[model samples]
Target: MKNTSAVILFAAMLASLVSCKTGGKALLPNVSGKAGEVAVVIDKENWEGSLGTEVKGLLARDCEYLPQREPLYSLVNVSPSAFADLFKYHRNIVMFNIAPDVEKQEIVYRTDVWAKTQCLIQINASCADSASVLLERNGENIAEAIEQAERNRVIINTLQYEETKLGDEIAKMIGGRIHIPVGYNFKKVTDNFIWIADEKQYSTQGIFVYRCPAEDEDPFTLEKIVARRNEVLKNNVPGMFENTYMTTSEYVVPGVRFLKYKGRDFVETRGLWEVKNDFMGGPFVSHSFYSKDGKEIIVLEAWVYAAKFDKRQFMRQTESFLYSFEWDKE
Candidate 1:
């Protein structure tokens, strides 16, 4: 009887978490579709015109730092007339409403409109031209909203099956908190650095956690961040062969941007990684930000190595765990 009661309590707690995440009183159905995919709703007229062209160009652009060309999002265009209940449950959605009756262009970004963890972006415009203008003005924001939605799904799943031991280890190692998925195993742990990876037959998803003194005269620059990673990975992360190590790719310069995400300021860097004197390579992303006391720069980074497959989703999934980071202050 006690065991059954415990199980019932756990189920209730999980349901409550889902309720909080979806912001709905009633339980919402789990979102459908694959990661890094979006369903676009538009009429056939706009589908063949410049509006669809622009939307495709924005959402389906080539993902950065991959060995092969894979779109940031695999878009499945759905005609509004054919958009049924199934399509409404997609994880990411971009819908267009173009009508003469629309007095002003309005863009409504809603979550959980039709399904849990769904990102439904409704653009109401007077015409295709006006819709295009709205998209052009807010293209970056739109993409980010979809990206966050994708990450939220990953974070939710991670929380449900989190490895509490790894979370405890991270808290001890770096004075930080992050929800880790079950498949990951601790690769290395030290005072200044920690490495964990989820290894599989087709892909390798890895993460590194470390801290710097925040003492660099001018820290948080691309040059500084890249140089630091090269130094750290070279000594710590080795390759298949002797003297081979991981380093930032010299061929492709990294890009860095300042973001205030989830109520904290951090510098996000995106670039490719290559094995020194070897052929293996893939993409990497990291977030660098100051600790609570402002004395140390806590850096959380994730990398993907999938030579046999397209790596956009792998990279996103690995890095999205970092987005679940929170301050586990003592």
Candidate 2:
């Protein structure tokens, strides 16, 4: 796999150099102006319109080699029976259209790199059947092109397969998961939180979460801890923390929040805020308990955040995550 990746990388580099020879001019014969240009046809007999505008956006962003906006050239609904012969002489072309009655979109993508052109047709439903057909300088055999194009289609479809698998796993664990909508600006999953059990110590779990704090709060202080806990309990309907926790008029640092809930001690501290402002908000809460007359202390720490989300939902999710914690016994 590593070697294959390396070869692909090298090939891409070589293709880029070849593509640049004519100052990035289109490599295939310019048929847009020629008479009787073969129009690539789409067979919508089995196609269902499942492709959404989001998929189109992804193609535009990820596959920049093909013209998307205003499409340099297009051939729509050319008779499918003639598609094979239409492009027999020309291997480089971009073809796209929605299937007749399908709810999703489908696109047939091909591009020229030097004299070799690769063709791939993808339907939102069965994207994996698409193949990347690589044609030699002489010409591409229609049968061989179709077979290879199917293989490439399968490769492209792997992405959807992995996504569906992960989505199923997440659905089994939690009520919901977070994902950026298709057209939104890309942002890292900073606000999402998860808890993972320690590898060596099966009973112990680390609480991992991120937050953007309010301007007045310092994430590391005891005061912040009390305030956040109280706020969480108030807004989160299923929260565990209640009035049993006492707010302390003390500070691990000045202006920091401190609190003790039940028998567990907690402190909140601030962190570097990256997105909204110069300062980012962060809170680390943990339970510390003593065994055998306070001789040994066991501290279980968790990161917390209150960022751009529904407070009730965030609290509920955080509470559920926190409840999964368990102490490891030696």
- Which 10 consecutive positions of candidate 1 have the poorest summed lDDT? 2-11
Question: What lDDT does candidate 1 reach at residue 42?
Answer: 83
Q: What's the residue-level lDDT of 202 in candidate 2?
A: 18
lDDT of 1 at 127: 83
Worst 10 residues of 2 by lDDT: 63-72
lDDT of 2 by residue, 1-330 (tens): 533443344345446435544554454443231211123333443222332222223222221111112221222334334543455324333333322233443333344433233443322222313212111111223323433433333333333333333223223333322221112121112222223322122121124322323344234444445555434423321222332322211323323335454344544332211112123233334443332233332222333334432122222222233323222322
* Highest-scoring model, TM-score: 1
For model 1, the stretches where C-alpha displacement exceeds 4 angstroms are: 1-25
lDDT of 1 at 185: 92
Give the alpha carbon lDDT tens digit for every residue of 229-259 in model 1.
8998998899899999999998889999999
TM-scores of the candidates are: 0.91, 0.19
